[model samples]
Target: MERSLLTRTMARVPGPVTVVTTLDADGKPWGFTASSFSSVSLDPPLVSVCLDKGASTHAAFTTARHFLINVLAEEQHTVARRFATSGIDRFAAGDMETCELGLPGLHHTSVRVACSMHSIVDAGDHSILIGRVEEAFTSDRTPLVYYNRSFARPASNPDRAEQDIRASHIADW
Candidate 1:
């Protein structure tokens, strides 16, 4: 399997854009923009996010006791780009503030999940950080998405209510 091929293939699959933040040993905030955040379990309320092993904040996140996953709103494409960048103060914009669990949380996000580090699993050149969700916050804002190596906003379906009814019927199974 060619790496570029995999990259291109995965790029077509849209994912939620998030900024995962944690405090380092020095209590300084470190974060990176990620599109690989997901729910892992329901019984214990687990969530997982991926971080590149070579990322500048990898060590801080892998060892941090707690972190926040800020699900960026559709209008926050700039915030995603800022955090994704390296060698600059990502928090200099001051959009993030101390929130749940005393971690830096990005404002106006569609969702925010605060979690305690549960475990870290090594996966090739990346590490999967699993967390036990401590709490979550949400707003009415639409989430930002990443697809084809670019930021996108999910389109609203005009027949959403009908779709939901159909989905509810499937849930009855």
Candidate 2:
């Protein structure tokens, strides 16, 4: 199959937007905008993110056991773009707060989760990094999504903080 066609096909796979953040060997931070993220296990609370082989953040993540997943809000499209691109300091250009793991988490994101690498799977084109959630913070804001090769805001509101079960409607997912 043609690579461009395959990319286009994959692009249509609508997915939630997340910026996987990790600290480099030198203790510098790096982030990548990714839609290839999902919750894989409920027991013990596990999350997964897929990173491309050529991604700058990949090597850092390979050695770093801990990282943060910043689930973007619809308003954070610019943040996503900055992190997705190269040759610029993504963190220096944004307003952010550091997590306990020292990963940069977008302050305005709909949710932020600090996690330790549960496992790493060697997928053909990308590496799938599974994470065990250590701490999570959720906000009552609509999420940012990616679809058809572009960014999007959620159609509805996502309650701030899943601190209470009553706030997360099962129907939202």
User: Which numbered prediction scores highest in lDDT against the true structure?
Assistant: 1
List per-prediction Cα lDDT, in the order shown. 0.95, 0.85
Q: How many Å off is the CA of 71 in candidate 2?
A: 0.6
Which residue runs does candidate 2 get wrong by more than 4 Å? 157-173
lDDT of 1 by residue, 1-173 (tens): 99999999999999999999999889999999999999999999999999999999998998899999999999999999999999999999988999899999876899999999999999999999999999999999999999999999888877997899899999995
- Candidate 2 weakest ten by summed lDDT: 155-164
Displacement of the residue 10 alpha carbon in candidate 1, Å: 0.2
Query: Residue 121 in candidate 1 has what lDDT?
Result: 94
Per-residue accuracy of model 2 over 1-173 as CA lDDT, tens digit each = 99999999999888998888988768788789999889989898999999998887788888887999998999888888988998888888758777757777877788888899999999998999999999998989888999998987655435544444564665567
In model 1, residue pairs whose N, Cα or C atoms come closer than 3 Å (at least 3 residues apart or on different chains), thus clashing, are none
TM-score of each: 0.93, 0.84
RMSD to native, candidate 1: 2.0
| Regions of candidate 1 where Cα sits further than 4 Å from its true position | 160-173
TM-score of 2: 0.84
